[model samples]
Target: MKKRLTWAAAIAAAALSGCALAPGPSLDSKRMHDDLGAPTDTTVYDVKLITPQLIYALKQADEADAATKQASLSTQALPAESADYRVGPDDVLGIYVYDHPELTRGASGNAGNDMSPLVDIGTLQASGGLGGVLPQQISALGTNGQGEVDTSGQRVAANGTIFFPTLGRVHVDGMSTQQIAALLTRRLGSQIKNPQVDVRVMQFRSQRIQVTGDVKNPGQLSLTGSALRVVDAINRAGGGNPDADLQRVLVTRGNRVMTIDVNNILNRGDLRQNIALQSGDIVHVPDHTQNRVFVFGEVPKPQTVFMNQGRLSLADALAAAGSIDTMNANPRQVLVIRHPNPPLAQLDGTQGTVQEGLKKVSYAPEYNKPEVLRLDMTQVDSMMLATQFDMKPLDVVYVGTAPVSRFNRVLTEIMPTAQSMFMLWSIARNR
Candidate 1:
C-alpha cells in the first residue's frame, strides 16, 4: 500500500507539472514589454580625469597633507603689474624738459625750451634708402636764408633729424623714449647750460594684439602704457561664456604657440602655466565640444544628459538618466553591454567567487545550519552579471523579465495537493 501511495504521489506530481492552468490573466508571471521601442545601442559614459580609486588613494594619502596642498595651491604672488615692455613701431612719444625751456616741446608752441608743433612722423620708414623719411613741411621758427632769427614760425623742411639746435640725427626707431631723451640731453649738455629732458608716450597707434575665438567681441586690442595680461585680453574680448573651456586657451605669437590653463591659474592659483602675452599674439579660446550621454528605454525620462567630470557608472548613470521606470522596470534583469575585454577580467573574478562558493556548497554537509548568504549588490554594483562586462563609452542596458521558472515550480508542487483535496471533498459530499 505504501509503494502504491508513493507511485500515486509521483504520478500526480508529473501530471500536475504537465497540466496547463486555464490561461486566465497570468498574474503569476511578470509582463515584460518587448516593444520597448527599438533596441538602442546607445549609452552614455562619463569621462573622468581622476578615477574614483585615484581619488580614494589621494584622500588616504593626505590626512593632514590636504591642508598643505590647499594652502600651496591658494598661495600665489599677488598679480603685480608686468614690467616686460616692448617698444613696437608707430607708438607715439612725448618729449619734455624740466627746467630747460629751450629743450622741451609743450602742447602750445616750442616755448623757451619746448619744440615746435607736434610732429606726426607718419608711420616710421623702416625701409631705408635716401628719401626714406617721408618729408612733410614743419612750421618752425628758424634763421631764413640770412642767418637771423625769425619771430614768426615759417614752414620749413625739418630734416628727418629734428636738429634739436645742437643734437644731431637721433634715430628714434628701436630706441625707447627714455633712451632717446637721455641721448638728446647728453648731446645738448655740450651746447646748452643745464639740460633736463623727459620722455613720455602721447599716443599708441601701432601696438596691437589679435584676440579671437569663443568671445562676445573679438578684435585687435592696443596696449598703452599699462601692461596687458591673459585675463585683460579675455575681458577686452567680452569674456568667455559659462561653458568655455578655460583650460584649453591658446596664445600664438609669431612662430611659437603657448597653451595657458586659465581655469587652473584662476581657481587653484597655479601660476606655472600662466604665460605672458606679447604684441601680435593671438589669444584663442576654442569652442568646447559637447561631451554627453543619451539615456533611453525603460527610464523615467529618456534623454541626453551631460557630465562635467566626463564619466558615469551603470548604476550612477541610471540615476542620472532618471533611473528605471518603476512601473515597467525589471531590476533583476538589468542588462549592461560593455566592452568584451576588460570587463571580462572583472567578470572572471566575480565568477571565480561565485564558482568557489558553489564548489564549497557542493562539498558542504547535508546538515542545514543557518548560513548567512551576503549578496553585495550595493558596492561595485556598476558591474553587470554576464560575460562581456566592462562598459565602454556608449553601451545599451536592457532590463528584462523576472525569472519565472522557480515560481512555476512552486505552483506545480502546490496545485496537485489542492486538486486531490477538492476531489476527496466532492466524493464525501456525494456520500
Candidate 2:
C-alpha cells in the first residue's frame, strides 16, 4: 500500500509538470513568450498598456490626421466652376443664327420636317450638354423656340463632327460650344457678313458617371454643360442610406482610386471635399456593417459591438459584452488585439492592364502585423482610460482569467485522472 501511495504521488507530480498546458479556455500573456524568445525585449505583437496619457495622445493624433487630410484634399479639389465641357460623340448641338431665319433648318416652321439644304432643324432638337446639371429641364431650353434641344437639334456623328449647311461638315469634336460658335462664325463670314453664330449643347450623351452603394437611388449621372461635383451627384441621387459610412466613400476613376470623406461636406459643411467627378467615375458609399469590434473570454456575454458613426470607445464595447465575469476573471489583466487595414489599391478591373501597351502595375496589398494590447483593469484609472480609448474595426477585447482560478481548473482536471490511476493501482495490487 505504501509503494502504491508513492507511485500515486509520482503520478500526481507528473500531472503537475504538465499543468502548464491550459485545462480550459484561457488567454495567456505574451510576456512569458517574449522572455522565452531570442533574448529580445520586444514581444511578437505590439503590446500597449492602456494609460490615461496614451489615450489622450491618441486622440490628439487622430484630430491632427483628420485636419491634415482635410487641408490636403481641399487644395487638390476642383474649383466651384469647372472647365466648360467639350462636345463628344453622340452629343447633340443646337445652332442658332440671329437674323438668318431663311438659313436656319427648322426656322421656317415646316414643323422642322422639311430639311433645308443648309440647316435641318427637323433633325436637330430631337437630340442634345445636359442643359445644366438638371437634364430634366433640357426639354424647356430650345434654340428654335421648340420644346427641347434634345428633340430639336442635330446629334453629333460617331466621328465627333457635325454637318451644317454652309459649313458643310466642320470639325466640332472635342471643341467647346463657344469654340465651335467662333470657328463657325469665322467660316460662315465667307458666306455672310459677320454672322452672329451661337452654339449651345442641346443633348449630352457622350459622358456618364455611375453612383452606387448605400445611396437612396444608385444610378448614372450625365456630365453635361459643366462637370458634376461629388456632392451634387449624391444629392441628385437622393442622398445616402441610414447606415451609410460617409467617412470612407470610395471613388474609382480608371486606374486611380480616391477615398473621400463625405462627412466633411455634409457634417462640417466643408465643400472642398466635393471634388469634380469625371466621366466613368464610380462613387461607392459603404455601410456600417464592416465597422464592428469583438469581445470575448471571461465575459457574461461575448458578442460583437457595432460602431456608431465610425466611432466606438473601448469602454462601450466592453459594456456591451456585459463587462467581465467577476467569478473567475482577472481584473488585473485584459487583452486587446487589433489588426491594421490593408492598403486600398484597386485599379481597372480584370483587364489587369491600366492601359494598352502600358505594363500592368501590381497593386498587391500589403497586410500589416496585428497588435496585442494589455490593460490592468484593476487599476483605479483604467475605466477612465478605456472611456477615451477608441476602438477600431476588427479589434478584439479579451478579459484574462484569474491565475488562481486557472490553477484550480488544472488541479480539478488532473485529480479525476489521478483518481482513475489510483483505482487501477489498487486493482493490480489485489490481483
Candidate 3:
C-alpha cells in the first residue's frame, strides 16, 4: 500500500508538470465568431456577414418546403373528388330500377331481414348524445337527401359483392356506382326495354382514417362522402392535446411516412400544410417532450426548454435557462448552433452531403456543417432582433464565455496542482 501510494504520487506529480490542462480553444469569442455580426437594418448587406442572410435564406427554404409539400399533395396524395366514389364492402348502396317497383320496393330505409339497421352515431357521442344531435347534424352523419339509405338497400358482402334481384352476386369491388348501374342496366336489357337503373352510396363505412398519439380524442375518424383534410380530421378528433407537437405531426400511410407542419396551418393559416388525408392514414401528433431547444455555455442554468407550438425565441430560451451568466458570458458573441431539420443523422431519404443537408442558411456553412447563428445580446438593436428571430427545434443557444473568464478558467485549472506541488516541496525540504 505504501509503495502503491508513492507510485501514484509520482505519476500525479509528473502529470501536473504542465502549466495547465484546460480543454477548448483559448481564442476569444469575437475572434472565434469572426463571420457573425450585428443584424443589418438594410436589405442590401455584406454577403460576408452571416446573421442578415439567415432570415432571408430561412424564408426561401420555408417557401421551397411549402411548394414541395403542396406539389406532393396535389400530384400524388389527394384523390380526385369529381370522380365517382367506388362502392366497397360494408357500404350501403341504394339501388332502384325504374318501372320495376318490385326491385325498388324493399330498399327504401334500413328495414331488411338480411341486414342490420345503421346505428345512430350521434347517440354514441359523449357530449350531446342522441338528444343533443341537431336535425342537420344527424342528416350529415347519417345518409341525407344527397343519398338517403334505403330500407331494402343491400349491404356489400365482405367479398365486395352485392346481390341484386336479377344480377345475383356481382363482383362490384373497385367499381363506381355509375359503372355498377350501367352493368345492371345492360344485363337487364334482355328482360326489360331501356332499364333506367340508379345506384347511390347511402353510407360510407368502408374507409376511415385513424387518429392516435397526443390528441384529445384518439380513434378512427370515419371518412364521409366529402373529402377530409388533416385539419378537419384533427378537429373531429377534438383537436390536439396541450402538449402535442403539432409542428411535427406524423401521417403514416402504408409504408410512406410524412411529417406535417400543422402549426403553420393553425397559426399562420398556411393552407399548403393542411393536405387532404386519405382513408387509412394514421395521424400521430407527438408531444412537445422531444421538441426542445438546449441552452449551454455561460447560461446560469444550462438545460432543455420545451417550445410551445414551435414558437421559442432566443430571448425565451435564455429566460427559461435562468438568463445568461452575465459575469462570465460574452453577451456580444452569443452562438446558436442549429442542426439541420430531420438532422443529418436521420436522413429523410434524400441523397445529399453534410453541407447540402444544412440547406444553406448561415455564413458558417463552409466550416460548420450545422449552422452557428450569432446574436449580440449586448447591443439593443441585436437583442430586439433576437426576439423576432425564432429558435427552431434542437437549436443549441450558447452564450460564449468572456475572455477574462476563459483566462480565469485556465488559472483555476492549474492553481490546485501548483499549490499541491509547492506544499510537497516545502515538506521535503523541512524533513
Q: For model 3, what is the error of residue 400's alpha carbon versus the real structure, in angstroms, after optimal superposition?
A: 1.6
Please write out the lDDT profile of model 3 over residues 2-31, one tens digit for every residue: 655575577567667653555766755665
Candidate 2, residue 77: how far the Cα is off, in Å: 7.9
Tens-digit per-residue lDDT, 1-431, candidate 2: 77766766776677678867848887667645554456654535658888877777867976786676666555543334648888888876667665564344322221121122322433344443222212343334333454433234667889888788766787888898899989988888999987877776665777788999999999887787666878888888888889888777878777656667777777878776778888788988888777788899999999989887777898899899889999989987788887643212232233232211112334322233566778898888889888888987678899999999999999999998888777767754764
Residue-level lDDT for 186 in candidate 2: 88
How close is every model to the real structure, measured as TM-score? 0.45, 0.69, 0.69
Off by over 4 Å in 1: 1-52, 56-84, 100-103, 106-169, 290-320, 324-377, 380-431
What's the lDDT for residue 225 in model 2? 67
Let me know the TM-score candidate 1 reaches against the reference structure.
0.45
Candidate 3 residues lying further than 4 Å off, grouped into runs, are 1-50, 97-101, 105-152, 189-197, 341-344, 347-368, 420-431
How far does residue 10 in candidate 1 sit from its true spot (Å)? 47
Judge candidate 3 at residue 287 and give its lDDT.
91
